[model samples]
Target: MVFILDTVMCIVTTMPQTKVPLSKRERTARRLTLCLMTEEKQRRPRPSVPYGPTAKTVAEGVQKMRKRRQLTIYELSALLKKAGRPITPSAIAKIERGERRVDVDDLMALTTALGVSPAALLLPLKDSPHQSIEITGAGEVPADVAWEWASNERSLPLSSGDASEAELGYQLHSLPPGRRYLRSRPVGRAVEALRRDVDRVVEISQRSQSRHPSEFADRLAAARLSLGRLEAELARMEAEREEFDRSSREELERLRQEAARLVEEQSRGGGDDGAGVD
Candidate 1:
């Protein structure tokens, strides 16, 4: 009986144990663990924001301006070349494709080439869907005026004439703020008319020498008076324009100084107490 028992024990010990299947709860727990690991991976933080204007904004602005002007990339490159800052068509293509960032100098050149303001490139498009309140000449308004207008346009509305001028022409250093540029066509017409009048007077004055001394004197006096009046008008317009420009510049300077002071104050507030430094 002892031998038989030992034989049975040996057989049981030597036999391989049957493999057990995992329980439903165990399998579910393993699946949940894998899902939690995946969720943790998904919760990791993204990279830092890009500096300067976003690539997409710049690219869209460039392409939009180019198309609006009906220009090829090569043509735009040529225009920049003429402006003393040469850029290749491939470079323009890279910019339009959002593969490159534009430098300040390049941006100025691009605006000049495209005949648009720097704001046209730097500012978000105002005419986008569901956000189409007209910015009109908002891009060209002085920085302080822009801030005011943005905050409350009804309280400080932009003059329509000033806005129209801003949209049509750029400001000139030599002229008043809003009335800086006189349309060339009108000026040219005036000049041509003046030339014709001068020529006619010269012809009549020469003929008067042989005809009537009194008539000649009268004609000459009238011409001199007219010329003097024209000169006086021009001088008065010039003085007024200069005065206007001077005031505008002073205002702009004041705004700039105020902005600088505000920025300094903000910086100081955000920085360390500077107790350790000189």
Candidate 2:
């Protein structure tokens, strides 16, 4: 009996132990640990698409302007919604981070919301005037230069020589007549003033010639010199005007011919359609 009892005790000692049920506190602690692990995984950064130089410029510009205006992302989004083009705060955040591309519609909406011009967002002209910006197919150019070109303040520096005939035609066609001649107004006024001065000097010289020949000779010489300068300036202005007129006429003629050709083609097409119907 003693041997059997000892054998039973040895078997019980060697037997595998069963798992114990966890207490409430221990189970709760385990659940919390798993939740924390999942939260950490969720917070990990994901890969983002790289943005282009232009997109980066726009993003930076938007962020800079927003900060300058002391506007929150939510406020800007609200403003955009009020402007009839709604963009959410999340989308605005993505745009400012360059994680999202700003399309034409988005650009217009952002410009309106931010109270800035499209050019302001497109270029870093205000934030970093001296910085170089890369234009696709155009290579790198100064920010201010790009802004000026974008704003139509000046043409691009693509050509070393004077603007080509095609460029002149484009400008003449695209811009209003008043805007085209706006810059020349000052030149015109200067020319008129010079002409008046020349006329006054000539009149004075002529009147003084009868009274005092010596005085008249000196005055006449000065008047002649002034007249020569005025004549030269007028000649230059006349040449420029003639060139502009010639270019304008040529462009208009070309457009007329193009329109006539298009009309003839349409007429032929119509005739063919009529024959088919018959």
Candidate 3:
């Protein structure tokens, strides 16, 4: 059952110019949240395949590569030509459109031209299940929208790494465990991933608290409260799924009983006619 969110998924359009300075992990989380929130809230149609988060993430990646390289489409075309691949500006546009998939060599060319590491181009533009899509946004980017985009951004990534896994712990800070007033689904992959990250963070917090019990007590309490919030959301989603499953089962049972009754009535009528024949 594919349900369309009539509401537009417009969360993070223009990145914030200035906000709190974030650690590397926090920045990833903030970006993820901002991106995913947009996806969730902004469901507007786009002229691209892999529409929705996948398309948006790819477009964003292309844009990022171009920006990092400090090159316009024309410049990128020139660079590629000089490099011997001879990619056209039209082709660059097509790649950005998510119509054409670029190879690692293409990625390297863009990265080198942009003067950034290949890793920079490959930073999980899409928030994946493996990495936390922690994003932060202000300036009227609705919280619901931000959550959706950040949470689903991971589903958009076309590409991964040990480094990606290592950053997972820090990346989780910006994500919402559940949407406002709605419990995340029991099998909700996003919710489950959040839980896994929480568990890891909680372990770290516990060790820290143990080593400096008095100093970290306040922080530990705060973490516990957050866990409570997430658990509540998860519990609610679980209940909804259970209720839906029960209703489905009941409907099946009713149909079965109706069929059985019809069969019995036919058998009885057949017996009555047989008696007359005998």
Candidate 4:
């Protein structure tokens, strides 16, 4: 979006709007101008997203800190500036809306600016299969302790290919009372197998389609149309899922607040002591 805006601004600068109407001859002379404007409109870019646990992103860290610290957009923008970004509050707003994909560098800047560990903000949800990590306990454990645990012989079995994740869990549990870490390897193997399977399937499908076009010829264009509809449906379902999650969270928070209010009222009333004789 920024790039598109900049490009549009540049075009505007070069050809400012005119209150004067163009002559038929003049309009005909500048048909290329119309083509350029059409192209510009067609190429508008989507806004950018900040990587990590954003308020609207599917995670907790950034949202939790943003609420706990009670920071406003202006304040966040100031922090971003200090981190050398110098973007406006609106820019941050766009990022929060998940319009663009923020790369690794922006994530580092965001962590430094927000006074958080890069890991905390950037870490995916614990249950998200994208991340192959397990974290537990308190403040960032120092590198020396982690290194010591890594060097210890108790960090046994040396390879991640072992059959059981339960065994991995047990091994970690046995790691003599300090922080333990291991990256899972099975998921990588699974992903590679899936990729190979997909490639073979796609190759086979294409060959089959090419060899037997007559069978599906009536449905070929219709199949493309159906696929597009499915893609649109998937997008709609993704949006609905997000909306449902938001509604559920809002209801949960409202219930918590109501329960807290009731607790306060009960505490103030003091069961039977503060009430009239009953």
Give lDDT tens digits, candidate 4, residues 1-278.
87567655555554425677888666544554654676678787755544433333323555555556788768877888887877677766656556545557766776677777665554433321122332232223333232223334223232346547644675567644433332233333333334434443454456577765654463454455555555565677688899999999999999999999999988878966756665
> Each candidate: what lDDT?
0.63, 0.72, 0.58, 0.54
List the candidates' TM-scores in order. 0.31, 0.47, 0.30, 0.31
- Can you give the lDDT of residue 252 in candidate 3? 95
For model 2, the stretches where C-alpha displacement exceeds 4 angstroms are 1-50, 126-131, 159-163, 166-170, 181-278
Q: Per-residue alpha-carbon lDDT of model 1 for 1-278, expressed as tens digits?
A: 85446544544444223365667666555555555554556677765445343455667889999999999999999999999999899999988887677888999999999998776776455521123232343424443333323332212244565664553443333335433334233443244335434544575565556766665566567666666655666777788899999999999999999999999998886675564463
Instruction: Report how far residue 225 has shifted in candidate 1, in Å.
Output: 45
* Model 3 TM-score (2 dp): 0.30
Please identify which of the two predictions, 1 or 3, would achieve the higher TM-score against the true structure: 1
Q: Write the per-residue lDDT of candidate 2 for residues 89-157, one digit (tens) a residue.
A: 999898888888889998988888788998888877541333777865567877656765686645566
User: How high is the lDDT of residue 262 in model 2?
Assistant: 100
Candidate 1 has which clashing residue pairs, if any? none
* Cα error, candidate 3, residue 187 (Å): 8.9
Measured by TM-score, how close is model 4 to the native structure? 0.31
Q: Which one wins on TM-score?
A: 2
Backbone steric clashes in candidate 4, count: 2
Q: Cα deviation of 231 in candidate 4 (Å)?
A: 58
